[model samples]
Target: MNKKVAIIGGGIVGASAAYYLSTLPGGDQINVTLYDDGVGQATSAAAGIISPWLSKRRNQQWYQLAKDGATTLMTLARRANLSTDVYHQTGTIVTRTNEKDLHDLYVLAQERREDAPDMGEIKQLDEQQVKQRMPFLTRSQPGIFISGGARVDGAALVEKLLAQAQQVNLIVKRERVKLDDHGKVITSMGPQRFDQVIIAAGPWINELLKPMGINVDVRPQKGQLLELSIPDFPNQENMPVMMPEGERDIIPFGQGKLIVGATHDDEGQFDLSITPEATQDLMTSAQAFVDSLSADNIIRSKVGTRAYTSDFAPFFGRLQSHPHLLVASGLGASGLTTGPLIGRLLAGTLIYGGTPDWSNYEKPLSTYLS
Candidate 1:
């Protein structure tokens, strides 16, 4: 008999798992069912920045995962025939107000590149060079350009992934599901049993686990971003993603579309309403780089809840106590960068028989869950 697999959540991680497990070798032997409530999914609301090479974050494991994810995701995007509008390798322009700090980053990229050539070519750019690449940018900060950086259309990618996975024994549920007990998964439609279950449900994973007396160290953070349409801007599609030394980043998509903002509001709780203050804050930040940017160009605002751990590091694996259950969360804001690769790792563990060495990828899965 074929094995039955149930996946909770339809975001990047879950969708990627379904895509890989069903489309990869030996995929026809296992059936996949995906459940998604569609309540404030972070991936859809994300700006989709995939430039992990220039990040100053010191977590080596995260860096390693994101670095590899960059390569894997872009390769998969090409192989999957995702259009340039869906995902594009536009590279990235990292800016710093201080020249010394900018130069230090350049040196670091070069050193890291020795180990990760996928980080792509590194080049320092003067203010004029930066202006030429991103004409809308008015900031005088120097920049370091990493040629391998890319951008993604998170919502579109998930749609394509699920559509492809459905070609070979994949069922998608558009409603919320529940875990009634430690090993039993109960759904609204009816009671079901599966050979394996994977929970990639963002911050809400805790809610599912709580019924079984398990509360993983996870919390929900609300994120807000804005979309702008600048029709007259030249080379919007060819422009590199603008990543300043702060929370705000500017991503250029095809045809006059620019994605901006994204605040990590811990106090926002689960509220999905757009905040006027957040819009003002984001516009102000964007104005710092583009003085010509006007609120009139605003298209829409995106709000979603992101999952984070106490230590801010992501962990994924099967629990020792429940061998049939696998869980992954705590991706925070970098979900767009690390999610798909993590999903592949989970599916590979089961599809190929036995756990792969994940020592360098993360700490013990026990660290995130008890």
Candidate 2:
């Protein structure tokens, strides 16, 4: 009998890890099972923007992971003969609506080294130029910075990955997991023993591992988003746009719909309910950029929770005492952008001889283990 590995959570991270693990040498001899209650529905809710250059100021580990993960997703789509259209690399335009914000953006741009190739160009666009590029804008914002970015239908990508994993005989289970002292996983659906287990359950990771002595600081941050339909706008298919309004981000995605969102609310207490206050705030912010945006154009709305760590960096690699257990969560808002590469790194550490070098990413297994 071959060694079995069980993974918790069926979101992008879990699915990507399963897919990558299946392709490894002697991977056919290993049994891989993925467990998730809600599967890809909960934590994956987002505009799924793949902007590697947008998160330049983050920790070095996260920056490298986001860059590599975006590349990995593009490569996977191409190799699977899936439509490259799934990844819309139209680039992004980030605007600064005020003097203070413009100064901040300038400072951020100046910090970049001239030798760095991942950084996008910081250029100013006048009112006429801004309108010419994005006709939906009623008036020009103070300053606009256009950069290389990409977007994807996150739900569609998950579906494709699940299908691919099924083709390779990876088991998919929808259930809550119960773990024993020896790191064996048992669920209501069935009981299975594995040599190694990976917990990628996002915000729910702590809830599941509290009994195992691995206390992680993963908290849920709720984000509310609205999809608007407006066919009258020009350059609708150009690419996604990111506007810096105070500390909030207004991102656009899909057909004529714009994903105006995101509220970092810790007071809500992990509830995934969309509050009217958040909805109103998002709509008000959206109108600041596009005056024509209204409640009537709102087609649908949803609220999703993202997992964040105290240090804002993801927790990966095996546990300190429980060598058979591994963890991969706390990706925060960058899960879509960093899922694949993290999956690759985690799978390599779990299945291969030891930890593998991740180029620019420096979160080695040693950093997590004592």
Candidate 3:
């Protein structure tokens, strides 16, 4: 019997899951339909960093999850037929403001190196080396450079995933969805019955699930970004991603556009407004690293609402309340990094009918269901 699968939310997670299910063997038996409203999604506005080694997280489980997320980027790029430039292997320089912070980062790089040798040539960079590598950078602090660090154009990635999924006969719908009784889904187009429903919606998960009396601990985390045009910056092609001193990061998107972001604000709503305070804060910190950036360099600014969870871990698995309903969300900032792996794991679970090892990171939404 064919299993009709409804994927609610057309962001990275949902799109990737639909792509995997449409392409994988035995997936032909699973009819997949992906619905998306394209409003307030995180993937489009993500900084798209894939270097998990830069993170200070000590939890081995979390590290492994992030590692897998980083590892799967190449495979996803290949599947999407995207070039390396599009999936960007520009590498990343993880630095700090003070000696203490640099020492902490050094220790973390050392500790995680053995487990993630795929990160490629983890080396400590001195001030001169940092400046030479990142010509736009003005900070003189030493940092750790992961040669394998990469970034992706999130909007492009989503477009490719949706396009590829459609090539394999996956239905794509642009509409909001709601759950009806008897485990069926109702979209603006119409109501449809599916054997399985995966909610990979970003911050809007609750909007669809609430009417059905289902709730998860996922909420919207707004991150604002500033795009600066530096057409004259030297070494534009080879400039490494700069993470200097604080939470602010600079990702050069080539063609003289640099993405400086971001601010994590938990305002508890779908607010995409870019505030003057956030713009000033991001611009001030960004200029501290890239000496060339000025107020005039500012081209544009945008905001994305990420799906944040109480535990900082994404939930992915079947809900106890609705056996047919599955969830893959709450990825926070790592959604673009771990999206492919999430899709692969969820598709495998639905098709093969086993937990399969990686599902350990996929907590059941029922745990936080209200």
Predicted structure with the largest lDDT when compared to the true one? 1
Can you write out model 2's per-residue Cα lDDT over 321-341, one digit (the tens) per residue? 787887887787778878877
Candidate 1 residue lDDT tens string, 1-370: 8899999999999999999998778878998999998899999888687888867788888889988888889888977899877788888988887879988998988988998888787889988998888887777468899888888888899999899999887999988888876767888867789999999999999988887778799999999999988764766787788788764888888678888968889998688999998998889888878788888989999999999999898889887878898899999999988999999999988787687788888888878887
1-370 per-residue lDDT for model 3 (tens digits)? 7788888887788878888898889988877888877888888777677788867655555667778878877777766688655687888888866777777787878787887876887888889898888776666568889888887778788887888778775898887778765557887767787888888887787777777777678878888889888865765766788777765878887678788887888873578888988898898888687676778998888788998778787767776667777777788888888788887788878888854554346544555567
The 10-residue segment of model 1 with minimum total lDDT is: 230-239
Best by TM-score: 1
Ranking by TM-score: 1, 3, 2
Residue pairs with clashing backbones, model 2:
91-149
Q: Alpha carbon lDDT of residue 274, candidate 1?
A: 96
Off by over 4 Å in 3: 232-235, 357-359, 362-364
lDDT (Cα atoms) of all candidates against the true structure:
0.87, 0.69, 0.78
> What TM-score does each of the candidates earn?
0.97, 0.86, 0.93
| Cα error of candidate 2 at position 274, Å | 1.8
**Candidate 1: stretches off by over 4 Å:** none
In the order shown, the candidates' Cα RMSDs to the true structure are 1.3, 3.2, 2.1
